[model samples]
Target chain A: MSGAHLLVRVGETTAALPAAAVRRVVRSLRLHPLPGAGEGLLGLAEFAGEPLAVLDLARLMGAAGVAGASPAVTVVTWIGPAGDRELVGLAVDEALEVAELDLGAAAAGAGEVLVAERPVRLVDLERLGEEA
Target chain B: MSPELVVVRRAGALWGVPAAAVAAIERGPEGVTVRLAGGRELGAEAVVGLSGEVSVRGLAPPVRRRLPPAVAGLALWNSEPVAVLGVAAAPAGGRR
Candidate 1:
């Protein structure tokens, strides 16, 4: 299926999220760590009067563990079906742009694609949120 | 004859995998996961690129002794030695 996708950089790789699942993109926001939050969960941030759970995409993807810096932006996303969705904020290095993606033609696992000759991984947001 | 290889950068070392054994290299939710010819998927930090052609030359055969459990053997590429990773030994979520 053809739909819009939000492209964001996580560490050295670029990843895409379904535009429909994304609420908005924001600059680095203060995150309050949640006690006992499991791995990959960065913390929580306030958005639309609600506490949005933030996740480190880099950590979730198990990329090279680089600890010196924090993500410079966040992509707020919602998971699950309508009316029962949960808000999540994904921390990323940069928010690139929205682009048209053919989900069918993308790679089977993680929906890989090439943009400007560089490979961009299209994340399965639903699966990612569920696993996290 | 030389073996065709795909060079990968994991942790801080370079590794080689026979190119024919790789089914697909895609971005995974947890990082770069390579689909092996056997259909198993494992995560990777970065895929350096294929080495094209590599000659074993004077290098000794991959020895069972003096090597880590995960490494299958040793080979020379660009005049340096690289570990031949046993992809099956890769962790569930890829190399940490």
Candidate 2:
């Protein structure tokens, strides 16, 4: 990891959603089905009595799951650009830790970015709304 | 306001089918199946639990489209989300 980032385990990928974009991390998101929602989208959740859309980070990354999965962690974050931002929960296998990721050191591309010692998928939180 | 609904659980989620439309609730190898008078079938992987009526609200377009046509709307039962189903298929692709 090089720059300030919040590392979360989304299936087999260790995704880094910018720390600034992360609102909060909660233990497990209880989800309801959004039957026609895209594969990456899970369903809905309530945050402070308000409806919240929960998206599966693993499904979005296209990996799906990791063996020996731990308890689920819901990362509430803002997706999309400012003025068009929305609060959405990104559910992952677990929240690893907040670390500094050095993208300049590794070869990263194709929807992935280099972090610390490995290349992890790069999630564009900004463009998420259109897909869900 | 919506009318009476027969609670049906399928594929690990709770579903609400209109009371008037249900012919019989049976248990077989496919798990709990809610057979409709119109010859439509709503099957579940888990056992069907028909409980009291639940209130339902129309789904937001984004939420409605992702689910199968069988899911009519949404309801909250026991603080859990329930997908209220309609007997007729939704307009498009509705595979689970």
Candidate 3:
């Protein structure tokens, strides 16, 4: 897969996750909530007979709540200690275009404004699993 | 080697879980829910409340609360006290 950064909005602010880390931006997928599941987890979905965990990115970043029937983009990254790839869906207010930027030039820790205006950070696919 | 751990900084505090312990990390109507190695799960309410970084109960604590020198370097993963599962007692010869 091409190495590019995906610019997305948690609410008003823009944040980026690596395009490579993202399996695909899906819409209108039925998100089922798991009993006693954590807050950030939207729920589990059976994609091709395999159950995948859906993650709420906005909830993770402390962003605004998504409105009803609004479109969301799911970024499926691998999780688990053994590097078992798990699909985690991030709920975003809007799905921005993908862009390619130099790693060094990509800003880090610039706060929400810088992220929306310019490429604020480099998305590390490996780290997503470790951190998620 | 153990599976890599993922570190997330929420609400100014850091927390980590064995990347393996995390079955999946997802955004929900509420907040970030981290599924553990087993079916057990924990919710980062702050992440759900959008309140920034906040702490919550996680996995069981390890028997050796203090990590050995060999694992000290891994302490960086403790951006916040991550929910850790306890280590089971080894058999006579250290067999699991």
Candidate 4:
């Protein structure tokens, strides 16, 4: 089956998330740190007047932490099955364009697609939500 | 005594796989190939022959404790830490 994927740069690597899962991509916003927030969570940001947890996709993928400064954009995404959706913001260094991915039926696990000749890690939002 | 380990580099990180678990090591045009016992082949930047036991002590926790499901854990190599990715975990695009 074919599906749209939003390509974004997390640190030096490129990653893709299902376009249907992404609500919107927004420029950097003021963040409010949540003390004692567990791993992968950078902080909190307000999206559409609701508090959204910001996740560090780079860190989540086992990449080194982003140095120098925070990401410039956040891709808001919906996780979990319909009727139980949760909103989350993914911090990305750059918001790349969307691409129509073949998403073959065999697609499963983490590393499953190559976009623009670079291996793109497929973010499993449902699994991530369960972890969170 | 420490266990023997096979060291390989991937995605700029050093990984240590138990030597017993490695089925074969081959060189390819793109990079070295590590064949695990389970029949999975992984591209490696460099594969160092079996080495002595590695001390797990004093290794810091991964920056993100809950790594992507594919990663097994992080371990130190030559005084630096690298992620030890799960061999059974298929690469992006399912081994394409």
Candidate maximizing DockQ? 2
What are the clash counts of all predictions, listed in order?
1, 16, 27, 7
Q: Weakest 10 consecutive residues, lDDT, candidate 3 chain B?
A: B87-96
Clashing pairs in 4: A111-B91, A111-B92, A111-B93, A112-B92, A112-B93, A113-B92, A113-B93
Model 3 C-alpha lDDT per residue in residues B1-96, reported as the tens digit of each score: 233555543333333445555676766666566665556554553331211232222111121122221112122222223322221211111101
Per-residue CA lDDT of model 1 for A36-114, tens digit only, reads: 3356666545565544556777776666432433458989887544444556677888889999987776855357877
Ranking by DockQ: 2, 3, 4, 1
Off by over 4 Å in 3: A1-3, A69-71, A79-84, A107-132, B1-96
Runs in model 2 lying further than 4 Å from the true structure: A66-71, A103-111, A129-132, B1-96
lDDT per residue for candidate 2 within B1-96, as digits (tens), equals: 365667655545666777787788777866666678767776665534454665565543333435566666666655666666676762221123
Candidate numbers sorted by TM-score from highest down: 2, 4, 1, 3
Model 3 TM-score, 2 decimals: 0.47
Tens-place lDDT per residue, model 4, B11-81, is: 54455666766788888776787787878766777785456765422111222333444445434455444
* Fnat of all models, as shown: 0.00, 0.15, 0.00, 0.03
- Listing every candidate in turn, what is its Cα RMSD in Å to the true structure after a full C-alpha superposition? 20.4, 6.9, 15.4, 16.8
Top candidate by lDDT: 1
Worst 10 residues of 3 chain A by lDDT: A107-116
Best by TM-score: 2
Taken over the whole model, the C-alpha lDDT of each candidate is 0.64, 0.63, 0.45, 0.62
lDDT of 4 by residue, A23-60 (tens): 99998765544333457766545566554556777777
Instruction: List the DockQ of the predictions in order.
Output: 0.01, 0.13, 0.03, 0.02
Candidate 1 runs further than 4 Å off: A65-70, A81-84, A107-110, A129-132, B1-96
